[model samples]
Target: MYVGEMGIDRPRELPWQELVLGGTAVAVLLGLHLLPDSGGVDPVYELLSEYPLRSVVVGVPYTLALLSANTAVVLLGVAMVRQGLLRGWLTTTLLAVWCLSLLGLTVFLKDPVGSAGTWYGTAHKLCTVANFVSLPALCALLWRRFRTVSGWRGNARRVGVLAALSMVCAVPFAAAFLRYGGQLRATGTVLGLIERCIVVLDIATIVTLAAWSRAMAAARDKRRFDHEVI
Candidate 1:
């Protein structure tokens, strides 16, 4: 019997459109740091949110990049669900929370460094924490799911590694905030550097998952083609 006739679900390929969108978002985010209007803030000491407030040049692009990234993530999550990679409501909820937190980051910009926190700023901080917390949890879930599926163990290990790195990066990021009593001006800690590393790993994890789905789809097609030829 064919794979489908044997009650196996074929992997759902992530669309090229989603990959392009995600790639564009990553490019834009990385490119933003190169702009001349960055307000002279030290990247190692300060947070990325400080950039947008520094100038309109950075603000507009930063907002657009985040929105694009959020959209790409939502599309990817849906693809994973259809592919049976996200098998339960718990995983679905985690994906939703991560996406929503990303949206919140765009909507409620953090307060300027060393400034008093406003309501929106407080909300922004909450969302930042949520975003950091949720993505790694989702990666852990994906790792568990991928480990059991044939042809997916490599990706499972990759995702597990990314999740571990994310958690490790979060340590210093969190410590900097806690040391400052939840303030953003922890100059002694490499808060910006750690945050940047976490962001890169998070994006890399998403790309890895997308690559896994695409690879599975290709392998499934090849198996079907061979079965038909035989």
Candidate 2:
């Protein structure tokens, strides 16, 4: 049943504590993305190229980390939504896609081609774009849809603002992807400043989502308190 009919109120977002922690985790991942790797092609991939790690040691541990972290964040987002939070789905989905993207990166990292430059480069480039640049776009779309689904009236203007921010944030990475992606420099598909800008957008989006979740929770709590007093 809809909370509106049940006398249960939904908050505008989740609690502040949740928002801070969740936002911080997202930021750490973002930092990992921004961290310069060997100052060239992904260091993880580069090292794997020289010597593949034992499946037991590297592969299993990495996979577990990716899956566990991603799942935890997704559940946290869901919990927020369950308590009348909004934007939780998008946040959950964003974290999931990102974690999956990292998991996807693990594949390329372990099997980077040493002899064939162009072919391996292309594959890695595509994965980077898909995971790094495009995933944010997916997240943004989800956030917009989530807001609409929240059934919050007169939120068109707010949604519009979010849409605009997403587009603006996308510009840098999009350009970087097109420019340095194919270049066979030492960097090998490593994007420059533009990519960093896209990451910044991702960071902003994460924070915004967290805030939105917190607001939803607060609103719900307030409504419930008011009813008990009356």
Candidate 3:
């Protein structure tokens, strides 16, 4: 059989269009969530709690956005696995844990102000911790692997350095949250801004990995075709 007929096709890459749709949904919904006065919610100090968005009057759009974001993240992991870009059982496990953490955060809303120590509140905190912790751990664990991977080395090194810094920053952010989050008040603080910066970094890390995986897969596929033709 001719090569085109004989060669098995690689699993299809996840379309970037899908990722963009998911990302846009997340961003727009989050912006809307910030509207609605939040009943004097200090966006700076309020932990970006989804509780406000879950309101009866204006919750639907925010809920849809969150679910879309969740599905996008989970789908990204699955795509990496299918493309054989993630590598190893440990890597796969960490990816799955991170995705599960995202889902958990969506399903378990945090307690409202003055109700910080409630059961659901605690559950929300646990999910938050797990989500944040798993991300850095995954980055650290994959650093060396990426550094050595045939086509992904350079991107891996850059991501690894960023990952280490992000983990270090998470320490202070978590501490600050625990200490002052109960107050649910931060009128003139940069801490909330810092927290948002961390969120940006986290999103960057995920996006970088997705892009890297697709690039590597495409390169490999091209090389395979070239060899077959030669």
Candidate 4:
């Protein structure tokens, strides 16, 4: 992949994408939650929240601490993108940039050059909206890669399909479940628990898969050595 005409080689960037998305979603939720005791999330309140979402609302700075923190995380993703996978990484990186830029609008809200208020909110919403598009881009890449993988894994076809679909929906659905989850959930903590579980479970699964693959390769080597000695 080329960033400003520089070539970058990244490997297994799906994990990176997951990390960044999870971070951004969590940051936004936490930021809003920490604000002085707001009643249960209401549409009218949400609308009002957006009204003052600029950098200089009432001549005071907005709470951009979390948003800026997310931008730093996004930059790390960009920096790390130079390692084997392309299709998933490329699409994900693009979506991430867009999302970060939307959030960035707030940091510049008061500046003469910066966009603020509803415009920034609209852009932020737009970037979040584009997340659905990112899903398809990643799915296509995974589907193509799946087609190429040597059928070494049992049920290769099924695994490929599932991976492609799971990755695509992971971010977007999680966002929806998070934003509106309180209403549908019996307890507000359910979504939080679910998010934590998903993060831990997914990371553990990927690490386990990597370890298993290495073990298989080692076994293959040992068998070859035995045959050669015999």
Best by TM-score: 1
RMSD of 2: 7.6
TM-score, candidate number 1: 0.83
**Clashes per model (N, Cα, C within 3 A):** 0, 14, 0, 5
99-185 in candidate 3: lDDT tens per residue?
787677667766665653777667766776777778788888778776786766788786887688787767776665566555535
Expressed as tens digits, the lDDT of each residue in 5-124 for candidate 4 is 122222322445545654565555455545554223322223212324322431132234335445544544343343222235575565465346445434433112133335544454
Sorted by lDDT (best first), the order is 1, 3, 2, 4
Tell me the deviation in Å of residue 109 in model 4.
7.9
lDDT for each residue of candidate 2 in 1-230, tens digit (9 for 90 to 100): 11343566443333455445545545444444454542233432232222223334344444444444445545555664565443445544655666566556555542333343455455555655555644455445554566565444334334445546656645544455445443323454433443445545555554555455555666666667677669
**How many clashing pairs does model 3 include?**
0
lDDT (Cα) of model 4:
0.40
C-alpha lDDT of residue 44 in model 4: 24
Candidate lDDT values, in order: 0.77, 0.48, 0.68, 0.40
Residue 49 of model 1 has an lDDT of: 77
What TM-score does each of the candidates earn? Answer: 0.83, 0.50, 0.81, 0.37
Instruction: Give the poorly placed runs of model 2, Cα more than 4 Å off.
Output: 1-72, 85-95, 110-127, 132-190
Error of 4 at 8 (Å): 26
Give candidate 1's error at residue 156 in angstroms: 0.8
Ranking by TM-score: 1, 3, 2, 4
Error of 1 at 56 (Å): 1.3
What's model 3's lDDT at 109?
Answer: 69
